[model samples]
Target: MLIKVNDRVEIIAGEYRSRPAKGADKVVQGKVLKVIPSTGKVVVEGVNKMYKHVKPSQRNPQGGRLIREAPIQMSNVMYVCNACGQRSRLGVKQLDSGVKVRFCKKCNADQGEIAPARKPAS
Candidate 1:
């Protein structure tokens, strides 16, 4: 719930665990990647993946195939600590600017800032 971008989260509530993630994955142990507050979904590096098929165009001319992606729910994962190399629950600390930062409960390291979201212009 307190996770941030670049926070290495662990699959505390998913089928994947104790293994290196596969698919378009990164943040194997760091960064939150993305957050979907409305749906409570969060994208972790190399976590969830789905395959897709595409029709071949002039580029392929063979009715080729393609794959797509989607983010998983944040509630399914927990932050991991750099010090202990283990998934840790988060602790909240309010800064002087009234900003809340995520701290690792196991090692007390800051999970860093959440990056600004990119959006398409209307």
Candidate 2:
């Protein structure tokens, strides 16, 4: 997953693309909340919103519509490089110390490393 958690991304496609509203930039930027590589989807902050009708519960006395972010296809987003501040492609590079890291293809700057998954405990 090149676009991991906390990485800033720009919505390039889908319904969330830039639209005239009030005073807003033409390009929408947000951080990645979750990445579902299995489904090729990503939950970006403040994008692809959906409303969930909630029932009354102990936590809430009144039930109402809950707005939340919905997952968008990974192909619909592009990685925004923190280094160059531009939307760019991601690429892998290996260091002489035998460490592999993700880098911005446009600026050729190091982004970060993907941590290995932890093993399940017995």
Candidate 3:
């Protein structure tokens, strides 16, 4: 999956896209905390929050509800380009130095290097 941890993303589809209140951003955007490539799901910060009920245990003297982010389908999110500050698709390209990097498809901005430059063969 192109989406990686720490990458900022915006929800393109699903109920999370709905604004929580007036004057809020139209889309839900957050940093990717985790990615499950096998299941095609990603856990984004501040999105898809779910409450987990916990009983009193040794770990917690007082039990309470904990809010956590739930995984959402990878297809529902679009990468937000760090350079252009816009949501766009990501593409991988190899530079002349042989470094593979992720780039934004909309503004053609380089996000960051995915792999180190390869040494030329003797």
Candidate 4:
């Protein structure tokens, strides 16, 4: 998938249709936490939230609950344009280094920058 980790994307057509990951078009600013290309799903930052119960721990010591972003499928999301501020499909372009970058289809601007997945230091 062209979308990398940390890429900001939006939901296109679904119950979340027309709404970005944050429940509005303004959700583009959210970063991509994970990408599931095989399933066409992307875990957007601070979006698609779900609750989780945690066992008693030193920090909680009371087994509380927490909310987390659930994975939204790629088909349900699209890349947002920084220039036009619209959620649109992406166009692939080859750079000088032969690296393909996803571009905004609406405004034809280069957008959706993502970082390579990094491993935490041991």
* Cα lDDT computed for each candidate against the true fold: 0.64, 0.83, 0.86, 0.69
lDDT of 3 by residue, 1-122 (tens): 78889999999998767644233344478999999988999999888776779998899879998777779899999999998999988999999889999999999999898889988789
Local distance difference test, candidate 2: 0.83
Arrange candidates by lDDT, highest first: which order?
3, 2, 4, 1
Clashes of each: 9, 0, 0, 2
What candidate 2 gets wrong by more than 4 Å, as runs, is 18-27, 115-122
lDDT of 1 by residue, 3-116 (tens): 656767776655444443465444244356788778888876656644656677788688655543357767777767767777878777776655666677888887654433
Q: Is candidate 2 or candidate 4 better by TM-score?
A: 2
Model 2 per-residue lDDT at 115: 48
Cα deviation of 111 in candidate 4 (Å)?
A: 2.6
Candidate with maximal TM-score: 2
lDDT of 4 by residue, 1-122 (tens): 76778766765555544453443334434678998878878888866666679999999899978777778777666766667878767787766654556688888887644433344479
Q: How much is the lDDT of residue 36 in candidate 3? A: 96
Instruction: Rate residue 69 of model 4 by lDDT.
Output: 75
TM-score (all chains, Cα) for each model: 0.60, 0.82, 0.81, 0.64
How does model 4 score by TM-score?
0.64
Worst 10 residues of 3 by lDDT: 18-27
